[model samples]
Target: MKRRSLIAAAIAAPAALAAPRVARAQAQHNWKLVTSVPRGLPGPGVSALRWAERITQMSGGEIRVQVFGAGELVAPFGTQEAVESGTAEAYHGSGSWFSGRDIAHSFFTAAPFGLTFDEMHAWMYYGGGQELLNEFTNDRNLQIFIGGGSGVQTAGWFKNEVKSLDDLKGVNFRAAGLYGEVLRKVGVNPVSIPPGEIFAALQSGTLDGAEWVGPANDLAFGFENVAGYMYAPSPVEIYGGIEFGINLDAWQALTDAQRTMVEAVSEAEANRSSADTFHANLQAYEKLNAAPDLVIDTFPDDVWQALKDASREVIDEVKDTSDFHRRFVEAYYAYARKSTEYKRYYDTPFLVERESFFS
Candidate 1:
């Protein structure tokens, strides 16, 4: 009986190995995607994994991707460089990670006075934002796609009331990219620390406030437990949208079929992440408000105006240095201004009245 079983197993092995060429090709073409987010088993970490799964399946398992998060394969801050150098083939993370490349990359994550999730998508998909973004990367041999967009964000969690413009003086805040520069202009001491460190910074008195993503993320990081004041209308970012970018060399090597699959999945998942975050924020608002000692607040008129002006100054500083930046921003604001005009006339009545909403 043992000899008969061994003979049958030997016979079955050949059947399983019928496709030798396909197996060899698949083994040779596996790729990797680096992410700054650390949690990898599921949820957000699974994003890169999902992209991997779809690409592999679509390419008949010839295109496998290994998703490594945060420090699994490289240091958190070094992902962009790693991908650019082909030390890793790709990266699935925030656009703000590459702010050093150009400040406009940070706009995809958060910009002072940016748009809502749906609005940005409309702008990106139909209003020509994606094409303009391509133009930004055209010279650098880089390609980016919106991996996710966290909708309208909360202003921030704070230890004290920010009732007037003067309150920001010397405030030690954790922020990033040009927003940091803009905040600096207002006399706030803006600092960049990894996202993993924000909760501890807030708890240990190392930070006066923080403008990390929004409600879904704020609650995820347990901000509701520490910061007593919750500010709204997160003008610096009505959205916290994350972008996934890859080195152009890797992208060019992909077969046309493989490229299409990656683009479609990344674009679709971006919409999913944005809408999911939008829903999560609404639910988190209730949870945040329910906690003890938590006060919901808003910046006064003068404070808002000062923030706007400071943000404008930062923009003026960067505009001419890169024509792509100048042209892209002009196109976006043209649509934005048009949207504002329409919203003012049509939606303000059912929405917040402009006098109350703006002033």
Candidate 2:
């Protein structure tokens, strides 16, 4: 009887020890991620898909992410709400689209005449931008991550040449966030059109002009087919940022290891997205530049000056919104001013010399 009892106890002890191990092994997460752009729409679209793949691979299948592009599961603008409602676990898109909720969101996307991709990242990763971002999103029950960016987008595709600042007046243009507001100050009528409908709007004359992204994406969308003039170096969107806003409940449920993996993959993908956009834009720009009857031009010096002046007025309105807005604006411009000072001596001169040497 004693030997039988001892055998039973030994067997139960092993089973108890193995239960936690089995549970740990089976701790899997299957998440649904939605994006604000159609699947395979280039740049942000590509980055969203890649982000899922990397997380699945990196987690060794412990975590799997399924991506739904714009309108696949919800409207492009509905992504944030979907995540908050648990209809989707996460969302990938530009923060600017949601600036109506908090004006500071525009900074998360791209500030008017603001930081470049590298400069934005410097502010986000080092200059306490992320901390403030967390605070801002926390109120809305979300956690934010800066995943990617489209660098130095072109001004846009215009049906007619913008010969003067007055030419911009009353033009129904598709621009977002502070860009749209700044353009408003300059007399352009800003319209909000989804990515999928931009071409149709332009073709039907519903929109006089539109700025989607830089060359790679704009070329793919065939903006040139409708608009004859493509302008460059948009002051408003120096860097078009892409971000992931995860439902706070879902984010908090992640294990420490899983959270680390997500952040690591996101940060790594940011670098990849920038590099991919640069190379693709370079190749696409060459193609667009050679396209027959397409006038690739830059905004005139006077127009550029007017834009800068309007941008100041728009930014001032934002700064008066709240303490948070003031902080974000201050931090952003501090870095921008510092970067400009250094780049004037470093990058700007080198680029001028390089162009001269090549010419």
Candidate 3:
């Protein structure tokens, strides 16, 4: 009887040990990811689709993310609310879309005459930008990640050239984030329009001008078909970034291995998306320049100076809103000031010299 009992106990122990392995192999996570751009568009749109694929590949089929373009599952501007409300598991979008919630949110996406792509990355990853962002999002039970960015954007597309500061007055323009606020101070009427609607608005004359993204995206949407002039030097959105916000509860549910995979993948997408947009813009610019009817022009010196002054005033106005906003602006400008010196000496000089060759 003792021998028989020993044999049964040994068999039961092995079976119990094997059960956990079997369950782990079968584990799967199906998540829904929504973006601010429509599916299949370049830039953030392509980045969103590729990011979802990377997550699936890295997880070895243990995780699968379903991608939805803007307004597919939720309105483009409603992405954050969807994630927070548990209607969606994750959101791939721009933080500036929610600037209404907190004007400081614009710092995460872009700022007028603010950080470049590399500078913003340095600040977010090394200089405590992410911590401040976390402090803001954590209060609302969400976690944020930098998903993608376009390094720089064109000023906008306009029906007529802007030759002086007076040209801006009373013009109905579509600008995003604090850019709109800066325009407001300068006597321009700035409205916030979604990406898909800008073309229609421009065609119908509802908008006198609109700042979308850079060459690749703007060209892709055929803004040239409606607007005759392409303006240069984006004072706002020097580096336009897209963000990924995940539900805190959903994030906490990930296993240590799964979480590690997510972190690594997010970093990869951030770099890849920015690089992709940069190259695509370069190619698109070549095509745009060849078009005879499209005239590319720069904002005149006086107009640029006026914009610079107004941008400062707009930023200063945020200081009186809250102590938290005050700290955020202070830190952002501190970093921008330090980075500008390096850029002026290095990047600015090289680009100026290089331009002479082409000219």
Candidate 4:
């Protein structure tokens, strides 16, 4: 009986010790995520809220994220600093918001006339984009995840029609990222305004034109009521990509399983948000087109050609900003060229053929 009791005691002790560790591993984490978008706004804002909900659900409530919109926890452009200072665990915003820190940051958001939606996704996930981003953020003591995107955006809302390149000259345009640089090259004065302030700028004649997300977000912001002309094929951001920037220390504090869960949910949100924005934009476009006061148009051929030329110049100038910037730009363009070629052969022709039948 004494021998049996000794063996049972040893087994029970080990089990008891292991049980606490398991419970600790499954402990709950309540994290705060600050966004560069206003709460409930379409596209990035809505996506952030959904991402937080998903993280909670996927982690079985072991990890709960409380999302704060622009200016709630920090100003719209202050998200990066907030994360870096450990004031917030994470941030959801476009990488372009940090371009002032390094122009190369714009590559992660969008490049003027750069990669399309599918191509951007391919480059970021399969190509070296993610690795480059990780390196960049790591230097700042933060980690980045490609969170969400507004597939392809509209040109902008214009108070008047833009019939030629001359119309763009001296126009007070509200632009961001590389698009602002490209617009400047073509003689437009790019106004730096936060997303929330854009509507008021336009209404008060502070801005001649502005490009927000797509029809859904634009309509929600009442751009249609302020501007008469809505243009298509935004040359600024072919694809608007948003990122999840988390503090390195906070991220490392998570268990391996928790880290994996965060990454998996972020990628899932990227796809889900893009699709949601696309569908919403489609519905909004249908409604906007029916409005008699609004005029939907595409840029004239000459204007588009000039913008294209200016975009090339802007790209060349930007690549020389720094060694890292040069490398990123070169890699991006190389991948973009390859993807463009593929689309030319496959996607472009298929779309043209399909449209011919419809017309």
Candidate 5:
């Protein structure tokens, strides 16, 4: 009897070893993704749609996403709330839009005199910035993933060129987040308006000037028709990037592979969107530069100086807000300091040399 049992166990072990392995079945997820911009609008708008597409495609039907443009499902600024309340599974937009809830959110999106695209991307992905974000968003029941960016936005579209620092005083301008605060410090009355209404506002003289994304988007909206001057080097928005805020409960439900797919797709889209914006901006800029009526220029030196001073004051005030703000500010500047050191030696010199060589 013992011999027979041993022989049977040996046969079963051989059979098990020879059997083919089966892959684990992944659960299907259907999500609604809301955006803060109109559907198909260039830059962040189109990038949001593409982000949804890539996730759906890469998942091989395991994860499906449906996207809703701003106001289609919820108001543009309601994106974070929608995801937090589980009204939507995810949201795509700038985190700075919701900075009123926590000033720390601005660093993840746009901060006055903030890091550049490469610097911001590195800070988030490798410099422990995302961990800080996780700490902030966990309380709101949200998770963040950096998705896309607008690289170096235009200064603004002005009805007339700002000739002096005094010109900005009492001017009603459309700006957002920390940008608005900095402008207010410089004596400009900043107004927060939705993107859809900006053109109408500019046309009707409600806004003396407005800062939108950059050349690609500004030209698309036909700001040149109402605003004669388009300025460069938006001080507050060196690199404004978009983020994906997912419902924490929904995120937790995702399989490990599915979660990884979401992150991988987001990183890929972030780099792609930045590159796409730069290319589109260059092409659109060339066209706008040739326009007979539009004038493209930079802010006068005095105005730039005033803006820089105001930016410093605003950022300093934010540091005194709370311990969280202090920590976030410190972390941001630490990385900025390290990054600047490298840029000075390599990027700045190379850029200057290239310009000199070309000219």
Candidate 6:
């Protein structure tokens, strides 16, 4: 009782869930966590297992986290809802998957050309993005972490080669967040499905094309198996970041020692996820390219321009209602614009630095 009340003093809305739950904790000794990702997706689940294992070992069997691979327990998209409602102790997922919760979530997952993984970490941890996201979570009896990212992603796989907007029109695709909105403008029938189903969706012919994470994840989803025309420079996505959630009651019920372990392990999971994607995605790309029939393509200049224009329209609509989102876009682009301008002096113009040996 003392521990419960004391812990509740520091938390804002969590006290509601913590107080009643902790009084009963003396009756139960360990925790069980449910996650949504499949066994191997190069995202949150893989990162979490490594850290969760360490916590299990250190706790000497007192603390336990049981990871439920996708569809093993709740449906993949149901993770956050499960956590909030106490069906699970935690959730491993991406903001992109739950953008339906709040448009503000889209900012965390990565806006089009928003921040890269490291840049987002910088902004989330030091630049107030974390505080903002938690503000949203805390309202719902949930607690969370930055949960790292899968970095950038390929545009998608396509049946017919896309030379221009003409190719994009009437195309049925798998996409998420504001990207879906942008796709609609370009005449794509964009659908949102959980990551676990992308490959099956593609395989069954329900989807004309799809893109999931970077190369590594795409490969894991068997993207290479169906690659017809692989496209790049996804005008709709720059970075795809995953988000982790902990039930507020479950988090607060832990002892101080347990609290430290949870925080440390979650942070470690974030780091591992980022690093794993960096190296693994490189290998996945090789597999994609190794196939003789695979046709790799980059969007022509006009196509890129058209997509960019459509994306801007989507951004403006998102900004109109979300001051938080608007501010984020403003701050992010502020940095990007400055970065682009500075790079123009030395990076954009390429004669291979004629004065160098190569010249």
Q: List model 4 lDDT by residue over 60-166, tens digit each.
A: 78788999988998987899999989999899988888988877777766687788778878888788787667656675767788876777789888998998889
For model 5, where is the 10-residue window of minimal lDDT?
Answer: 15-24
Off by over 4 Å in 3: 1-27, 357-359
Candidate 1 lDDT by residue in tens digits, 167-235: 889989987777788788989999888778988999998999998877777888988777888888777
Each prediction's whole-model lDDT (CA): 0.74, 0.83, 0.83, 0.81, 0.83, 0.72
**Candidate 6 backbone overlaps, count:** 0
User: TM-score for each prediction?
Assistant: 0.84, 0.89, 0.89, 0.88, 0.89, 0.80
- Give every collision pair in model 5: none
User: How much does candidate 1 score in TM-score?
Assistant: 0.84
Worst 10 residues of 3 by lDDT: 10-19
Candidate 2 per-residue C-alpha lDDT over 130-232 given as tens digits, one digit per residue, 9 for 90 to 100: 7777767766677788977888988889999999998999999998778888888889999987778999999999999999889988988999999999998
Model 6: lowest-lDDT 10 consecutive positions:
10-19
| Worst 10 contiguous positions by lDDT, candidate 4 | 10-19
Q: How many pairs of residues collide in model 1? A: 0
Q: How accurate is candidate 1 locally (lDDT)?
A: 0.74
Model 3 whole-model lDDT (C-alpha atoms)? 0.83
Which residue pairs come into collision in candidate 3?
none
Write model 3 residue lDDT over 183-205, tens digit each, in one string. Answer: 88889899977778999999999
RMSD of each: 11.1, 9.4, 9.4, 8.9, 9.3, 5.8
